[model samples]
Target: MADFDIELDASGLNCPLPVLKARKELNGMKTGQKLRLIATDTGADKDIAAFAKMTSNPLLDFYIDGEKRYFLIEKGAN
Candidate 1:
């Protein structure tokens, strides 16, 4: 897995918030950079997956770390 250049905590958020925040954060990041996102939403897995595909972001890794869901996403080429 790639090392993260940024870390975001989206825990306790629900629905689209986590994905939305991740999108917002990625907007300021350099392309190809990795972001480590920690979220607690049960729906985040599917939402983030779909969002990554839809937005052209590469989901480098995804796994559950204890009670939280971890996502390693690489910024897309613009």
Candidate 2:
């Protein structure tokens, strides 16, 4: 399994915050670097997807295990 370059725990944070924090981290990452965000908000499914689309980053993978929503994102070229 590919390890993420950055791991962000957004669990317990609500909508927008997770996506926003992911964006902030993604903004500083180089192209091709991956970020893993773990969120507990049920709404993260939509928020993270839209954030990736809007930011032009690629949503590498998404999964739900127990109460956590795991999202992998690759930073897009500048």
Candidate 3:
């Protein structure tokens, strides 16, 4: 399986932008690849979760570090 290689920094972006950027980043990855998303938007916690569910992608992990929120998502089958 391919490992996570993409890093999307959405720290300054808001709700939709964070999710939208993540979606766009995921689109450029192959199946089994992973994406690392960094965002400061508080809403992204919920938005990213819902985005993963809606797209059927797997959210490998999520956590908050100080002021930053990080998400690791694995690309799903297309």
* Best model number under lDDT: 1
Score residue 30 of candidate 3 by CA lDDT. 93
**Residue lDDT tens for model 3, 38-76:** 999999999999999999889989999987999999999
TM-score of each: 0.94, 0.94, 0.93
lDDT agreement with native, every candidate: 0.92, 0.91, 0.89
Tell me the TM-score of model 2. Answer: 0.94
Q: Candidate 1: where are CA atoms >4 Å away?
A: none
lDDT score for candidate 2 against the true structure: 0.91
What ordering of candidates by lDDT runs from best to worst?
A: 1, 2, 3
Relative to the true structure, candidate 3 reaches a TM of 0.93
Output the lDDT of residue 26, model 1. Answer: 96
RMSD of each: 0.9, 1.0, 2.4
Displacement of the residue 62 alpha carbon in candidate 1, Å: 0.4
For candidate 2, lDDT tens digit of each residue in 1-78?
A: 258999999999997899889988988999999999999999999889998998899899999999998999999987
Candidate 3, lDDT over the whole model:
0.89
Off by over 4 Å in 3: 1-3
Provide backbone clash counts, one per model. 0, 0, 0
